[model samples]
Target: MTLPSALLLAAVVATLWIAARSWTLPAFPGRTDFVLMQLSAAWWSTAVAIESIVPDPADKLLWAEMAWLGIVCTPSLWAFFLWSYTRGELPERWRLALVTIGLATWAVALTNDAHHLFYTAVRPVNAEPGAALVYSHGLLFYVVTIYIYAFMVMSIVVTASGIHRATPAYRTHYLGFLVVMAVPWAANAGYVFGNLTLFDLDPTAFSFLMMDGIFYWLITRRRLFDLLPVARDALLDAVPDPVLVLDGDGTVVEANPAAQALAGDHAAIGRRLADLPGLSALSTMVAAKPATVSGPLTLDCGGSPRCFEVTWVPLTAGGGGREVGCLLMLRDVTHRHRAEMRLEDTVRRLDLARLEAEERLVAEQEAKRALNGFLSMAAHEFKTPLAIIDGAAQLLLMDAEVKAPGMLPRLEKIRRAVRRQINILETCLADDRLSDPAFALRRDRLELPVLLRAAASAQGDAAPGRRIELELDGCPARMTGDGPMLELCVHNLLNNALKYSPAGTPVRLHAWSERGPDGQSHLAQSHLALSVADQGIGIPDSERERVFDRFFRASNTGTAAGSGVGLNMVRRIAALHGGTVTVDSRLGGGSVFTLRIPLCEEAPCEDRMAGMPAD
Candidate 1:
């Protein structure tokens, strides 16, 4: 075989073999453009091989024109593939424009009959048995040549710029790509300069076979196009997370600024994770041999304990068939960890406080129940004996004149004492009933003024020496409530006024009614007020609220002979009627206790003034 024919056959075989081998390797960065560039080189080789041996000059010219298709497209394809192999992505518009320009130049070269812009003239070979046809160039041919050279030069420049910045394995791969691209470029240069004239061969086609084998070896063995290096200065230093890259033997190969800061004063690169002072916890995690582990880990780092979320990621090669190294990333989680701990402590304390409060509440409720039982039992027990004594005194009073003159008066005093004792017992019993939650209001339509008058009369009868003046004037007669409860409430108030005042001092029991004094009405209910005013020792303002609490009496009451439940029962009775009892008093002046009930309807106005009666 002639030298040019032999080279062309070898070129075709090598290009085809590499294009096929590309499929077997795992998909990598530039596999698409690599396959296409190889295929185009193969096509060009086949056309060149046919053109070299063809007997007819016309057939050779046709094949030479066919071969131009690969010549025009191969460099641009290599340019794009190199860009994608080194950098990450190519802009779609740039890739498309490149392919369009390449195909346009190929079209011009093919349709040279119309324009003659690609080749000024085509001449047949001065044949030595296996000589290839050569063409004279036109303006467009040089333009296309320069265009092809620009693309190849750009591919070389892109690869060369990244070599120093690339990691060791990546630098070797980039150098290999540059060398393979340079083969065809140098061969074409030699041919153009008339330096490679052996047997009239186009050396560019011969160089394709050399390029194919180099690329195939680079891809399968070196993994040249698998991963590319990013701009380390921009990405690594600016990232907030600490990142460390280690080699196969666990030596730190790269450390970002964050990683350096985390490692303290010492440099981290070239040191093993086990040797790092601040990364003891991280070293232990790496030693555990887990494929991936991530969680909170604490490091003392020569100061207060710092917390980090540590991640262990093992780097792999050959689709995880080989272990390259591991990546140790640490992110500061101290603030988050402290906040979570504080929240946990707060929740724990609140839980303890809540349990204590619940226990106290249970104890208080038990004490209240015990007090109520004692009061109920005492009242019942006291009432039975008081009734018997009251009956005996009444019988003795009727027959006292028959015994002695002094015995009659003594029996009368005994009757009054028994009646007072009975009143006290009744007050205690009322307190016990009011304390019960099940005691519901049994409402009835009754004349409230009549109830108040009866209560005043009863009080005067109970304490004959203490005068109580009844004033039911201007009060609403009709009201809805439990008549007995309201009567008892009024009687308690009258008794309080009489007991607190001096003997012979007038205790004023007054009743009145009102429509809407304030807008604070529920369902537009009206109000009926019964006030007990005393010209006796008065209450202080501070003691008013507490006076209505169960078994609570004012401090100014001063050893008064009384059960404390009388006013409390009055307050409860008022609440049952959806009303309130309020007090007005001074230290020297006597006090007024007012029981105001909510009437179901607006009361009819009486033709009387609102002020109290004069002495």
Candidate 2:
């Protein structure tokens, strides 16, 4: 083959090699288009090489016409290749338009003998050696050339656009892409518009083949396809948070879809940060140029207020890692912000309620002190008058013979009434002391039967005719407790029983040494049981629990002279001794009030129980 045809064949082989290598590469954006572009260049060179070798002018013209297949496809496919490879993807309509133009150009060029719109005439320049055919120009030829040049220009423009956006490492690769676009475009432009040729043949295929070397270097050495525009798109578009990449001047450089939604009606890209009112605070903070800072930021989104946690980090680049811009990420925290506000409101309300409760407690305590003082003073002052009345009633018994027989009983009744009043006053005083904070159970060794017998005797004197029964079958002769409190407890129980029951009815008092659970009298397992049983107005079932409350009385206790405090005071004394007071009775039946106090608080039950013998 002549050197010219040999060069054309070499270009074809190189382009085919590039296509074969690109075909084996892992698929990425525009990889198919790139491989097709190389194949088209190879086909174009093959057809041109045939035209260079053929002898007859008719044969050369036929080959030249056949070459239009690859010639028409090459430039348009190169433009498409660059669009998919760097611009991420070419729109379908543009791709279809490129394809239609290529197929229509091939059809028109093939039928030039009839329409002659592509070439008016075709003839061989030299068939001897290093020569090929030339075609006379037609209107469609320049039109097609212009459009092909337009495709290359678009590819160059689109590829160059990304050089600024790419990192320093990839920016070199983008420049390499621009070189790839310019090679065939410049060669073809020179041949068509400037009458340029390489060895009497078009130099477009030769330059295009040389471009394959640069593309190979970019793919293999520069790792071109690894960092595709598609990856950048997927990463930025997938983020749910508003991501804004700003220049050092706080002008918006790049904003994803989320940022667009957040900006609402405002056009984001190319706009200054101050242009967005919702992002003004973030813009100011970005102006300060902090390395990293995050806080609450509120934004108006579609007329509804939404809160976000705006985070700013300086986007640094290059070997020096100098700040290029700030990446503002606004994470939605509306739900969290509103919840915090509600929690703060609840805490404030709780604090106010606590203050009100404390104030009420203090006021109630003062009122209680005043009421107790009045009762104590009143009790003290009336005792003298009560004593005088009791003495006068007794003295009238001495003069019973001077009066009617009924007068003696009437005087006796007056004395009994006065005694009951004095007992009531004494109960009031005991209740007052029980309520005192300083009041403590004065535990001392005492006789259980002796205590009960004395309490029984005191009640008997006050009632005149009521029988006070005492049963100390298993009672310990010695016990440990406050003598006055225990005696007072018994007196209060007996007093309540006698006052509520019929005047002729008798009340029973029982005391025993009782064992706790499992019949073991060790540790807290044992207690002393004292119960007062009286056939009186019994408590209703519903009010049984409340009967021990201070100032609480049974429903059946109608017209019964009671301060409603004696039983409450008894319960208080029992509790102070680490025990409880319980009642068991049915309505209209007698009630049994039992007080159980632990006998082993300080020591073992065996020691406290051994102190007394059976009574």
Q: Give me candidate 1's TM-score against the actual structure.
A: 0.60
Residue 321 lDDT (model 2): 65
Using TM-score as the measure, the top candidate is 2
Cα lDDT for residue 145, candidate 2:
76
- Candidate 2 TM-score, true structure as reference: 0.62
Tens digits of lDDT, candidate 2, 284-318 = 66766544545576787777889888777776644
Minimal lDDT window, size 10, model 1: 606-615
- Per-residue lDDT tens digits for candidate 1, residues 1-615, read 456777777768767877877755555656677777887787787887787778777787778778887887777877877777656667778767866776776677778888888777766566554346667877887787898889889988987987766655356766887778788888988877665744676778668667778767875564332321333545666789998877666677677878877789877776887788876567767777644555578887668798888777776656555666777778889999999999999999999999999999999989989988898898899888888998888888777767666787677778778877777777777767755766666657897766776777667767877777777678887887778778888878887888788887898887777666664665455688778889888887788667777677788878887657777787767766667789888776898888888777433222111231211
- What is the C-alpha local distance difference test score of candidate 1? 0.74
- C-alpha lDDT (0 to 100) for residue 180 of candidate 2: 75
